[model samples]
Target: MSGQRDRGGYHRQRPPTPSSSAPNMSAADPSNVPDAASARSAVTDTSELVEARRAKLSAWRSQGIEPYGKRVEGLVGLAEARARFDAEVQAAYDEAVAAAKASSSSESVDDPRDRVRVAGRVMQHRDLGKLVFLSLRDHTGDLQATISKALVPADAFELAKRLDYGDIVVCEGPIGATRRGETCVWADRIELACKSLFPPPEKWHGLVDPEHRSRRRYLDLHVNPDSMRTFTARSRTISRIRRFMEDRGFLEVETPMMQPIAGGAAARPFTTHHNALDLELFMRVAPELYLKRLLVGGMPKVFEINRNFRNEGVDRSHNPEFTALEAYEAFGDSGTMMELTESLVHRLAVASAEDRRGEDRVRTGDEDGPILPFGDLDIDYRRPFDRITYEDLFERGAGFSCREIDRVRARAREIGIDEAKLDDWFVVNEVFEHDAEPCIDPARPTFVVDWPSAISPLTRAHADRPEIADRWDIFIGGMEVGPAYTELNDPDVQLERFEAQLRDGGDDEERTFRSLDRDFIDALRVGMPPAGGLGLGIDRLVMLLTDRASIRDVILFPLLRPASEAGVE
Candidate 1:
């Protein structure tokens, strides 16, 4: 249950056998040594290159050159440095070399290999004995650096020969083309930015094992560069969401996670005891009640994007602690929330693929296109998503209207519902979820509105029909993205709803936390505004926008079976 374990911050490289190295392992010792501060790493079973690099750290310190490095100014990214390489400048240098080679009588022009500074983690360093091809990576991207025997001072050139794969280094080089026309930096000066003893992941395969990858995401991100891109896109999506809400004057706020009672949704809660108070507190199941309190306090518009904990199942779509974006608007109801939900989602989808011109998942081409792939399916966020009523969808699925009690009861019995022992609404909900839910179109986002009044306890009854509630759930790619509600503001009705929930039980799990939500009803009694509320699962949205499948994929540190990972099943 503890998530404090290291998530692969260190990947130690295995050592090459002494039999494969020079005849005497100690004979090739260079003066580049580590300081007392940067002592030889504690892990003994590391690669020969890693141990050699450690020796260099101690050797460098002996010569007053700190192997770990210091704060040197003027560091540009490796990608930015690579972008500065001009074909004309390289061509001119080639002409100068040609002229000098043609006749010793001709005056040679200045060689393009000169001073320029860059910094990055040493991603790859293949020792060719006479030549070194080192790939360095920063946040921007990875770029190759070439070190040749003829291009550097003898001592510095030898340092390049022994550079380890994970060391961070700052190189002063001139960018140019290789013999095959691949762009690279030819460095005349190289200094240790930071010495890394860790062994990187497999060069070509990257991080493939899910458990290893999740546990060591840093290595995964570095090894598989595309992983970072997914997280980066996640950040962009959240930013766009915030901007969309803020631009519409919605105030963002925070709420309590540890509460006396978990009141927002029907689910089991993680219970803990407050030592001082000797009182039981449950981790927040939702921010609904608290968000509604803000509506009572006269904040006309508000939203919160935060985590909620539930002591329940962990699956591809559900995590113990998940992020949710909930918003409330005064003087609004389900209709208002519907409009806001559509606009917010559509804008985010449009913004997500706005930079893409092609019909692919990754952004490319026109930068104004609307195609973002989600698991082999390219979702079009060009316009408003499809909308349908809950009854209509259920009717389409069950082959009869939900209002026909006889058909509903018959279908429920066939679908494994024990009708003789179940309440009408519960049976109906079970049937709807089991049958109608599958009818949703997987590609187009759809909202199923006007739920039965019995199931939607927190929502207001429909203005046109008292038997139905003003609630709607937005489904995209066969997943529930969000739900909107025209809230019940009357204190008496709110209290009645909460009390009624306690009277009706779904199963043991729901019974554990489905008590009368007194505090929320109390807030309602204090004159809460008639409001529209919306709850969006931010992590799921990020997963949708980024095309990540598991809820754990988007979460930085997801809950996992213990590393002693035995019988999780």
Candidate 2:
């Protein structure tokens, strides 16, 4: 098979099987063949293919050329090089060449085409005897390089002709368009950047297997344009969030990633030992506690975008490690946090809508509200996101009031939840999660406010209703995007709630990570202001905006099962 690589640096190849046939190699000495190849016929075909690439590596070494490349000066990216192509410059150069030819003089005419030096991995290569054409790709985009044997040095031309599909190359040339209307670089000089020892994937069917894509993401990034674009959008999305927050007088901050007690959230934490201190530590499940500590330290407004580690099961929406954004504002309550969240999400949605236009995706064409597509749903991000009370939704969904202990227990048991072991409010919350959450409109941004105080240990109790907390959870595209709280700042109340949570007999997994943070209670006792706090799932938010289905899709390098573990599948 001809190995013609392209910007999508892969070619199709089935893993060698026992029934596969190997092509005869005339240049390979029979005695020099690996004994394992003859011993195990199943690997013979793969061995032969590998041997061919290895031979090229040997030849390059014998010619005194390094297989790897060094930093080359004055080299531009492929996209930048392509951008330098100008129609007027090419026409002028063409006219000058024509005039020189007509005069029949030995004098050379000044070339008007823009000159650029560029480098990238060879995507496509064709050797047409005296001329060679190579397509190169960088992160920005791809460009074609046309190397003429008559124009370039003899040695450079020879190198171009023999270059393999995956080899990286640097070339200098005048930016011009081909006769067939393809923009290209007409190379006067070329150099080998690196010699690739492995064959690239098949050009027509590049790294298609999803499992293979995640495992070998390096290849996927080069081959899959969609993947590169997804990550680019993700980066821009994060930067926009940072800028948006900074412009609103919020100071970005960093918090300790490891803590003696995982006090932020109820999620299980990954544990580790600090050998020097002879003490144990857990990777922070959330930066909430520390961010609040900053508020206690006189920071009026603060936010952090960072990684949090949790011991959790993997799913389309969940990762063991994920990014979260936490913010705290002094003298603010749940209502204040709600307003901030609405403004931030709406702004991001508008930005994403503009980005969708750039990506050429279908738009709803409603300028009054920017609608972004998330899977099959077109989520509208108009002003005044729908807000409903937790009690109202639970009453409607469960067909009973949230305070109905008997009905809540019956519903929990019907859903196969063990109501006997858990507390009454816990059972009610379980029923609400199973029934009430699904009632939310997937096509609209919503906030479910006024959660039960018992379920929100860190939130302030409602002034009128002692059983309900002044809290709200934002949902979009059927996912809980984030939660906001009028934080509990009273030291005695906070301590009482912490003790109640510890005695709540949470599941074994939850109980393992649940513990009191004495220092955090001490911070509360130091007279912190009544404030609002928020924690958002940044990855999930990006997934909604970018139309990515899974958290893994937006994550650059998601945690994956080992190859050996995968082979068993």
Candidate 3:
């Protein structure tokens, strides 16, 4: 189709046809449509239906009504308005009306059902001559508004009939059940709020294309209730976590995202230079070091729930930018952190069960309690999570004890790793990760404790087993949810660990961001109490609880490549 450029620079193809442009317009079957990669070409700026909607905007202006409405007052939520429908009141009014009709009386009883003013985007519209039936939707839910020609003014009826899909409108009326018993608003007045400029996705197959859904998330949230529900649950989950921490006497604090030294965890960092200061900065991979400094400053209990950035690959559980929960408790050990982690997670699981059950009592333990579904598995979150020593798990899964250096190295080499150049502990870890990790039952929440000190640079060494660190990593559904550690407080040992890490300069990329945080060492010298630290991946937890398979599904507006960058047509 030929096109003409609009004032905003978008081209108008042609005026949309009435037959082709009703609410819930039936488009070509999605099965017949091209795959998502090629489907990007099907939608463009210049389109007939788009131009038609723009014409409605012009027509609205000509009629002395602004298509983009001003602030409306006294508007109630659609859900709240629907709830105002009193069954007893409606029955009384209906009975009185029937009595008047049967007696042929001229008198009438005043309609007393609750009256409300509400606004929403028009999702469905059926114009049958003089009457209009519309389905309006707001964030709360959908409500039907019925406008009869005899009940409303001539101009208001005309406005209701002319309304299109996606248009925002305000309705004022009494809430009552219709003849069909569907709770609806019998409209006495209707006014335009905003006119939509583009048609919504077809109703039957709303926003089915994955690429399209990500690119146009606004549409995705509106058209797909599942996406809406997932995000809603995510918000509540974060809120619940904050409340849980606060009730336990944890002070929430914020730390610098751009740090001079990214001395948290050993992960690749995204680097940038500050133009004003002429100094380089790295996006923090973890909040570990800064939080430790707070501990030195004598903050007894502190926590931070915020975003962390890392130069990492994207997958079902990985995101370059993600939310995390880091908490530190002074005078507490790794055992303390383990208890805290278990209590927090179990409470959350119970809350998830309560949310799913509504008013019903949530069962616990085995099949009776709240068993939240994670993918194909129903994770049992009852108290006393399964626990096993790292060494024992490694031996069981690798068919040899982790202390057997020769066997561990041989097994690493058998798995095609260059074991001769790697350290004994590194080889053991490699084998453990490759074999032992998979042995944990995905259906149970398990804690793998007592890692080797060589691999746990920040954990305090066990009293009896100096070679092993006092640390534990929690796993659920084959994914590591979080890790807890009895933080090392000795300034000398901490400094020695830092120096050792520096000497063992990893590859070029690792060495670039790896540096000694002298300030943290100084803080340790100032004396930090024996403490326990915990870091939980908030995004991954949300994914599991929400039953979302991909991290991208739980995160609203997850990073995506631009169409041009993706090479999509």
TM-scores for the candidates: 0.87, 0.87, 0.89
**Reference-based TM-score, model 2:** 0.87
The whole-model C-alpha lDDT of candidate 1 against the native structure comes to 0.78
lDDT of 3 by residue, 57-82 (tens): 88878888788888989999999999
RMSD for each model, in Å, please?
7.6, 6.3, 7.7
In the range 1-569, model 2's lDDT, one tens digit per residue, is: 11122111121122335664544422244553333334444332354666777887787778776667689999888888888899988888888888889998789888878899999888899898998999988888899999998999887887899888888899998999888878999999888888876678887688788777787788888888778878888899899999989998999999999998887788889999999999889999999989888888999999999999988899989989999989999999989989988999988888878767744443533565578878888888887999999999998798899888998898898999989977777888999999999999998999999998878889999889998999999999999989999998999998988898787646777887678998988998887899999988999999998898999888988998755422121
Lowest summed lDDT over 10 consecutive residues: which window, candidate 3?
A: 2-11
By lDDT, rank the candidates, best first: 3, 2, 1
Who wins the TM-score comparison? 3
Determine the backbone clash count of candidate 3.
3
Candidate 1: regions farther than 4 A off? 1-53, 103-108, 111-116, 355-369, 506-514, 565-569
Question: In candidate 3, residue 63 scores what lDDT?
Answer: 83
* lDDT tens digits by residue: candidate 1, 249-290: 999999999998887898788888899999999999998999
Ranked by TM-score, top first: 3, 2, 1
What TM-score does candidate 3 reach? Answer: 0.89
lDDT of 2 at 271: 91
